[model samples]
Target chain A: MLKAIKGIPLYLLALFLFIVTGLPFLIMFLTSFKGQMEFMTSPWSFPESFSLDNYKLLAELQFFGYFANSLVVSVVSVIIVILIAAMASYPLARLKFRLNRPIFILFMVGMMIPIHTTLVPIFILTNKMGLYDSLFGLIGPYIAFALPISIVIFTQFMRDIPKELEESAKMDGCSHLRLFWSIIFPLLTPAVATVAIYNFIHIWNEFIFALVLTNSTQNATLPIGLREFYGEFSVNIPGIMAALTLGSLPLLLVYFIAQEKIVTGLAAGSVKG
Target chain B: MSRLQEISLDTVHVRKKKKNKDTWVIIGFIAPAFIIYGVYVIYSIFMTFYYSTFDWTGIDANMVFVGLDNYIQLFQDDVFWTSIQNNFLLVIASLLTQLPVGLIMALLLFSPIKGMRLFRSVYFMPFLMSTVAIGILFIFIYEGNYGLLNAILEGIGLESLQTAWIGKESTAIWAVIATVCWQFAPFYMILFRATMVGIPEELYEAADIDGASGWQRFKSITLPLLKPIIITSAILSVIGSLKYFDLIYVMTGGGPNNSTELMATYMYKQTFTNFNMGYGSSISFSMFIIAFIVTVFILLGDRSTRGNG
Candidate 1:
């Protein structure tokens, strides 16, 4: 009992942070279920009754279209990033070449360059390529910005792969492509998961590129779509809350389901740098 | 002797041919990522600089070469200066708040406190939610009249402290800064927690044998070991704070008298909102330079400290 008393302050601090971090989400979630009248009448109180009206309103407003756009963009970009970044990492991790060090440094430097710095030129390039205001336009820049870190993670993982596997394959006359496909690439499951999760989260939540490169509602990703909801539904606070809740749901759901994968993946991705 | 020399020459020629083949293979592997990264990142950086010299609005072909005039004007622009100041202020505020708060939270996870799994899951949830959602949610939370923050203050008998948190110039930046900390501190917590978990158990056992207290153990062993990750987190926070957008843009649009205007937000308004593409490029390029310089400086300082230690 005395030891438990000594632990009270620790529990208090933990609970305080819990409320600080978790309360806003609770309020957002609970407020999402209240009717407009209830929300306006007593904003902090528990909802008198959980209503699906706000969610139904979102459904009528084509909310799922934004989800599809975000899904397509994130999936396509992550797949391409994994394939090419892993391919590039094979040579970078194992090969001896004149430009290897310089190339690696160049990609690493991309991490520090502000995305805003590349904004104007990419906008122009997208326009000139006739890809402006389209989902396809967002993919190019997404793949580009994701390469640096993806390569970093991939190369770090690849270096640990045993050389004996490659040497034996080479003795069987396996070409570099075949060697990579048969040996190196197969050994990269953990790294691929890490890259995919890290990039998926970033691209799914990406704002500036989507905001700039795509202008139409059909092409708008979730972050931009949520902002659009905010503008149109400003007076409808509960409805807006519902949109925010639904918008945040997919990622929160994924995080809960695969909590360890994401936590370790993100840590691995960043701690390497 | 001649036959031996012939064999040696033949082997050398074959090896050279293999080296050439390997070069082709390497290029083949690297070309796709390099092309994409080049056009979007490297090429865009140079183009940003090139466009900064022009007087063209992004919509039209009427490009007038301004020859560094935009940068010169940026130097004199009051809003630009204010935005720069705010960005630095964010950097400092984030370092001070996010890192320490993250450390405290991570430490609490390892404490004898109950229900830590639940605590950790909730702690990390804020980070998973999109930043735009956080910004919009907090907008209402900071809303003056019916906002949760004000209501809570009133409920707790702190009615005088309540106001439109983001509506006033004085409180706006700090309010957004607090929100920023809320969203990101958990990320740093994960980083610190991962490092802390890797710390060997024997060190604490050794400390206990010497009668060291909890704070003393943390100070002597944990803090010293945490130095590398702390530096890395600081670098990330500083660069992220400098280039911050989206949340600030969504929440305030850098408003209530432009109090929270970051470089990125200001650049967005200038280029996209006002069609000052040339000037916006300058601001963004300046951001690039500032981020680059700070990263290099931190890395160098980190390297030198490592050398001394």
Candidate 2:
């Protein structure tokens, strides 16, 4: 009975979680293929015509502007995040500085604070700096926000790098920079991969920063683009569904492909708890 | 003896030279990050307050002091109170749901299962999707007609459970709560499992030698070892829920007579929507205060627990 109980739950949970996670996506995909009447009548049922009409229609609308903006912001932000975080993590982690832990803790504290409290200030500062409407506005906050975890993870990996290895490099007349670039970097692949996946998904899914920072459709990210389907009074359900499917598909592909590292990254990202 | 003094002097000279050289290198590495992060954190916090005191519209700087008025209004406002209540409820619901579900899921994953690698990724998929999409997804799921939730309930002949999930004043909060729980459970599940996996297998062996039942062993060994992680997760949950806005904003928009107005959403409404920027800043100030206090409480709790043990 005990064995049966344990056995039953895993199976049931697996099924429940699978359907729960997969169903919304499935609905979006199917709804995009079906006509309005079919969606209204039988959303759960499969499409009768199997047409690409919805995609073609949305494409004609040139929703691709929003799509391109999203891709650029997420891609650029991810790249910048990886570069800045990788560069910043080194000295804090490896060097013998007095302020290492405290400086890290300060950033960690910054991480712990919610973005809402910081938004007003960011808005004011960015407006003053004339970056409000620019895509580059997010570069600063994105770096600040993503840096703590990236540093923490990188630092953990660095600390774990055997001291003897560094000492050996030192004995061989290598400068610290040379040691970091060659010996330390090549070995930190897993953690770096982990940080990249973590940063990519976060910047991809983020909405608040995107919403406040960008006003025009050309500057907006995918999440804001989807909001166009929602008006003050009414909602265009089918259109929004299509846009959501398009918006989330890239991350979903990444998620499905490189899932384990993403999971570890997500785990580490939230482990401040 | 003369040779020894010469060696000591040589060592001191090398140490001074190395320290002098490394100081510049350290400054090079540390200065840029310090300036950027410092301005972002310290300046932004002050900006929240400065924005709170002004009556200027967003763009132009026609600033006027509404000193203490925003605070007074916030104190008197029913919506603000409701928002605070909602945030507390959110914190409770998160603890209630994320803790057990995450722990159970973690336990199941930890239990020598196959295909967990795939399942772990699958569980995290919703998390990758934007909260906006998830909010939209749950909205349809909770719609009055043709919703998956209602359909499933009606199909099972539990028609009483088929009432409007997000539509009514009564059920909107629960609907939002479910959405929050669904998205975040995987996060805690991973955290708990990671810490759980780090516990030595030998402890379990020792427990078995003492004729400890599975439940007993878990209670005695696992719970004690996992206290730190559990506390950490609880603090995270508290803070996350306290400041939760995006999901609530998208799902219900804190609507149907504002049943779901979380603190963060309320603040957003005041500052941006109502143009009461000062009042919003007051709320943001309070928000900062609440966050600091809550964090302090959790840290103190961590200290006491470790001290007791």
Candidate 3:
């Protein structure tokens, strides 16, 4: 009985934190189902009826176009990041070269740079390359910004691979390229997963680059699309609510499905730094 | 003696040739990532500084070489100063709120509670959601009329406390800071939780045998062990707070008379909206310097403390 009483404060604290964190999402989800009039009448209350009207309205607005853009940009960037970052890590982690430490430090310093510092020049570069206002423009910056963390993760992981593996492969006359692809690359599955998950979430939701780089709805990623929805549907709160919920859904769904990998991946990605 | 010297020199020549080949291989491996990073990140950073010295609308070719004039103006600019102040405020607020709240939440996950898996899942949801969505959702939650926050306040009979949370300057920064904490606290929780999980079970068992209380165990064992992660989290929060843009931009656009203006937002307005590309580059360059200096200071402090310990 005493133990149970002692547990009450713990439960209360947990429940309080839960509500503080969870209530906005709950409100967002429930409010999304509400009609405009219903939301105005009772913003905090449950919906009058679960309705697909808001979602239907979103589909009419070509919501999936934004989804596809985000998917393409995020996937392309992440794949490129993994392949190239892993390749670079092989040399950086294992090779003995004159500029090795300096180069690694260069990439490490990229982590501390504010993205805004690079924004103007990249914007101009994209424009001059005739790639401004296109999905392709965003990819270059995305890949660039992602390299620092991805390389850090990859190099750290690669350094742990048994040196004997490289020596044995070298005995067979395995070129660096072949050796990387055959031996080092395959062992990077866990780090690759971490890099992929970490970068995907950031890229999918990446705003500033998308905002500056892309000028049209056709090229807009999900974050920009959500803002567009906000602007176009400002009066209809529930409609905006529906867009926010739907916009947030992809990541939320992915998180629920792969909860453990993502949790550990995110932790591992940052903790190593 | 001559034959032996010739053999050693031949081996040296061959070794040099092999070293040259190895260098090529290394360059081949690093070129792709390095070129992309160099152009977009390193090169752009220098170009930003170069752009800062000019008077040119980003759209036009009329480039006047202004020397250090843009940076000079930035020094006297009141709005820039305000944004700097606000950014520091955010840094302090994040460290104060996110770390402790995250630590508490992390501690709760380990408590003797039912449904922790559910708790952990829900707790981590905010971090996964895009900043834009969180910003938009909170805009409504902070809306004066028909807002969830006000409704709850009125229901609990705290009607006087209710106001347009993000509308008035007095409350606007705090409102956004609270949201920032909301979005990020869970991240720190995960970070702290990961570190806490690694702490040995035997230490706690030893503590329990010594009749140490819960708070004592945490203060002595948990806090001491969490030092490294706590430092890591603090660095992240400080740097993140300094460069924060998306949420504040979406929520208020540094509105209610520039109360919530951050360096990034101010830079955006100057460059994109107002077309002061030169001035904007100066602001952004300043942000880079500030973040770099702060990171260096923290790392130095960490190393010095580590050495003493």
Candidate 4:
């Protein structure tokens, strides 16, 4: 009886936190299906009837196009960042070279830089290169910014693997490229997953660069599109909420599926630092 | 020659060739990341510094340089100062709220509890959602008319307390900070929990044997061991709040007279919205410097704490 009584406080506290954290999302989700009258009259109440009109309206507004744009940019950037950062990190971790330390430090600099610091120059440079308003323009900066931490995470992960595997592969007449592909790259799967999720989430949710680099509807990522959607549909609360839900649905799905990886990836960055 | 000597001679030659090849291979591997990061991020930082010396509006490259003029103007700018102040306020608020609340959540969830995974995920939902979505959700909750918050306040018979949360000058920054705190507290909770799990069970068992109260055990064992992560989270929070932009940008746009203006949003407005590229670049560089200095300062504090320990 005493133990049961003691457990009550913890349960209550947990329940309080769960509601405090989850209420906004719950409200957003529920209200997305709510009609104008339902939302206006009973803001805190559940909808009397579930409605698909808001989602339909959002679909008509080319919400899927923005979703696709975000996917392409985020996926492509994640791929490029993981590949190049992993490749660079391998040498920094395992090899002895004159510039290795300096190069690693250079990548670390990216972690410290406020993205705004580089925005104007990168904007001008991308525009000059004729990459402005293109997905590729966003990719370049995304890959660049994602590199430092990806490299750090990958390098730290790589340094821990036993050197014997690589040396044996070398002694077997396996070329460096062959060894990396066959031996090292395979061992780096965990690190790759961490870097992949980290970059994907960041790039997927990123707004500033997407906002600055792309101007056309075809090029706009989810965040930018959702912003415009909100602006246009401000009066249509349900419609705006539908658009916001669509924008967030993909990432939330990824998070749920890879909860451990997502949590560890995020914690890894800070803990390692 | 013996077989061993013959193989050794051949191996030496091959090793030298491989060494030479390895150098090129390393260079090849590092080049892609280096070139892209160099040209875009690193070089852009330098460009920001260079542009800070000029008076160009970013429309054309051909403009006269007025060295330090933008920096001087930035120093005198009240909005700029206000933005810096807000950033510090955010840093303080994050340190005070996110850390403690997160630590409490971590401690409560640390033990074997019912539906721990569910609770964990629920707590972290805010952190997982896109900032834009979170911002939009908060905007609705903070909406003056037919908003959730006002509704709740009214439901609890606090109708007089309901006001424009994000529209009023007095409550605007605090409202945004509350939203930010809500969004990020889970991050520290997860982080601290991860660290707390690594803590061995024997210490807790021994403390329990000693009849140490839960708070006593937490204060003596958990807080002391959690110090490193605590420092790290503090630094992360401070640096993050310093560079924070997205949610605040979406929700407030640093509005109601720029009450919630942050260094990042100010830089964005100056460069993109106002076309004061030079002055904007100056602000950006200053942000970079401030982020760097604050990170190093926190790290130094961590070092001092470690020394004492």
Candidate 5:
């Protein structure tokens, strides 16, 4: 109760940080709707008349192709990674196996190997396998990088599940596979959601690989397309602003929808590590 | 056979078969992730090191083994050293500014202020958006003629302060670092705030009763409790800044004469732009070693800190 006055300064500081940090996003959003003349004349003002003309131009530029490509790559790779990570983590976390520690260490090494170190070789490998310039080429490397963290998260999550539950199921004459399929996987939804969201964002916003592996516009993901659009259409500031806004809309939507989970999930990953 | 001996033999046989089955089950479960990870990540790392030993452009199938020449050249390269220095600057900057700012933000939020929840989420917004998007936003913000930054300066009667932020060689890296700090400070804020929340309230209450000021209580109570997490966050920030690529890549392409060249972007430029595959591989290998050493050093520092404390 005595701290109510303290809240005034706190709120003021919060507002200051909020505006300082969020000013770019506010500017980006407002600038996207301004026309060329308006942008030039009053770059910081809100739009007097809302316009979607930049979006219309982007649509004509096959923006949806890039959107769909990003969606497919992020979603499919995350799904594959989730399934593989779940299967791998169950035994390591639950069962007593000879190779469990060694396997976990192997996954740990992946986390330490910076993605840049693997980039040149991945580029060469993808090209050799005829996957360069294809949307599919991104999936392999994405899954590989995604697997380490996914396995770690899944393993940590699985470790907390009581052993009595599995023991009871075993007493009911359940096979290991049936027990995992029926009982364990169902219990893993929250963990799976966390890993899925993390990987989805990672794959969606990943730039370097998408930059190197896929060269053609048709194969470009949102990041690549937005980058290419920025370079090729530097003259049209509003259009570039519009593309930036729309390009980030999907991720922003995901963040808003699962704000609690995203924050907690990322915190969980970093804190645990 | 005797009855007891026959029973023992039967049980042993059954247990052997079950053990064999379990081994296959383990293999089946772990194989998919392991295989993919092995091929793309672990194998690629080995291949990167192998490629470093050769003198070949990435364009063709042919290669010549050059032993350690690429590494020798990498050691001698001035630009490589410049990138390394830039990366060190990022690490120092993040340690000094981002962590402190994040800690301050987290501390401010520790109190039950009005609209605290909204402020927390909004503060983390920059971190949520893609780096590429942030890069584009900053590019517009830093535009020379009509950028928001210049406009703000002019509006504030500081026209002398306005300059092409990312366009000039001197200001490019600093501008890029500012954006990186903006994007990532929120990340550390969330991390530190989570740890701060776990601290017991009774400690603060006792300190208040003893008449300790806010800074005193924070120094004696919160800071000590949050030590492990502080180390962890520092390691994350340092390693993260070392491999920092996307935002910088998009913001300047390490440009205006390689002013913003990070180790990661330097590797990319060496490999892709120049087609110096061998040399690029050497740079990446060095990056890996540096990251490993930094991580190990932090862990060691953490251990010694814990030992002394």
Candidate 6:
């Protein structure tokens, strides 16, 4: 009887987390197909007809424009981050440089200060450079902000790459650039993949700087697009929901497809950090 | 013999020259990332400090330094205190709710269960979605009229319990905290489960051989092992909860009169809206001091725990 009672509660709790953790996403999915009257009347209920009406309406708009902008920014930034972080992390991990530890601690301190504190000043600087209202303004700071964590991830991963590779390359009298490019870069793909995935999601979802940096409708990214759609009020609910769904679907898909890598990436921090 | 010896020595010298160039190669590789990140982080921190003491708005050139005035004003400002209080409430709620809840989920999934791995991915669905979308989704959930929350309550025939959760001063902050905990708990749960997976299977088998029940095995094995991770996660939780912004901003807009305003949101408003640039920076500096102190405590605590373990 005691065992039976415990079993019941265990199942009940699982059911509860499953629901509470899940229902909001379910609602977002459900509401995208919901029409005005149906949404007002019954939000939790399934849509009366599976309608693409909302999706169809949103497609006619500049939907692809924001999608392109997000892709460009996130991809470009992720590429730059991986390249620069690979280069930076190699020495920090492998070399016995005098400044290496101090440089590493510097990154730790960088992680402490919230970027929001620096937003106003960066915005002012970006404005003065005439990079304001342009995509170029967003890229520079985005790379700057992403580098600390990327450097940390890469350097940690690089340490595990055996020292034999460097020694063997040296025995052959290979140049350092050639050694790294030919020997180390390919071996660090797992770390690069993990950091790239992490950075891509962050840049894709980021809103504040995108809002401040881009003034025109043409330049705004997906999150900013969502905020602007909010300003259109009640008439645009279905359209906005479609846009939100569109914005989030790619990430949801990637997370599912790369669940193992993502789980490994997360677990490393759990055990090690 | 002399000519042959000279030629061999020249080849050796060329090889050494190539290796020397390679030593600085690592430096060259890391330089760009370091330079860019270094300038931005170091420069912006002090620049904000300098601006905090001035009277000029973001656009203006006029700079007037009033020493310590902004810091003094931050203490007496009622809204600033309220924001700080709300942040405290979040720290408390997250510790109480998110941490334990994540542990429970982690433990449940940690045990052998059918389809638990599948459940893990599905459970993390909300964590992957944009905070902006989560924000909007909650606004719908908390809507006073024809909302999911009220509909569910009424369906269950608990009509009296229905109220404007995010719309009111009392419930608004708690409402935001609850959503945040729900969304993020899965992230921490995944982290904990990873640690759990690494524990040796032999320990559990040994417990069974000793006639230990499931409860006894979990208590003796799992709980004892999870301590380090729990400590690290707690520090992360504390630090993360302090900078809380995106979700709260989207839901309440810190409104029904400043109830859910976190430090980040409040800083944005003071600096950008009222143009109290100095005051805003002062509050930011204060928050930094608090975070640094907490971080020091975390590091010290981590060292002691790791040492004993």
TM-scores of chain A in all candidate models: 0.97, 0.89, 0.97, 0.95, 0.94, 0.93
Alpha-carbon DockQ of candidate 1:
0.64
- Name the better of 2 and 6 by DockQ: 6
Which pairs clash in the backbone of model 2?
A: A273-B232
- Global CA lDDT of candidate 1, please? 0.93
Q: Tens-digit lDDT track for model 6 on B38-124?
A: 666677777777777776666567768887777778889888899888888888888888778888888877555557676777788
Backbone collision tally, model 2:
1
Q: What are the RMSDs of all candidates, in order?
A: 1.6, 3.0, 1.6, 2.9, 2.0, 3.6
lDDT string for model 2 (B1-309, tens) is 699999999999999899888777667665656666766666788888877776756656677888777778778999989999999999999999988877876776655456866666666677778888888877888888888889889889999988888889999999899889888887788888888878898988877788777688778888887777788789889988988988988888789899989888888887788877677778887888888888888888789878988
- The better-scoring model by lDDT among 1 and 2 is 1
lDDT of 1 at A36: 79
Candidate numbers sorted by DockQ from highest down: 3, 5, 1, 4, 6, 2
Quote the positional error of residue A252 for candidate 3 in Å.
0.8
Interface RMSD of 6: 3.2
lDDT of 1 by residue, A95-172 (tens): 999899999999999999999999999999999999999999999999999999999999999888888989988999
Interface RMSD for candidates 1 onward, in order: 2.7, 2.9, 2.7, 2.9, 2.2, 3.2
- TM-score per model over all chains: 0.98, 0.91, 0.98, 0.95, 0.95, 0.93
Candidate 2, residue B237: lDDT: 90
Q: Taking the tens digit of each residue's C-alpha lDDT, what string does model 4 give over B1-309?
A: 999999999999999897898899999888999999999888998998998998889997677799998889998999999999999999899999999999878877765568978988888888777788889889989989777889889889999999999999999898888998898899899889889878898998888789888778878888888888988788778888899999889999989888889999999998899998988999999998998887778778888878987
Candidate 3 wrongly placed segments (more than 4 Å) = A1-5
Q: Residue B49: error of model 1 in Å? A: 0.5
| Cα lDDT tens digits for candidate 3, B189-255 | 9999999889989998888889888888888999999999999999999999999999999999999
lDDT for position A211 in model 6: 69
Q: Show where candidate 2 strays beyond 4 Å.
A: A1-6, A171-173, A232-236, B1-14, B110-121, B197-214
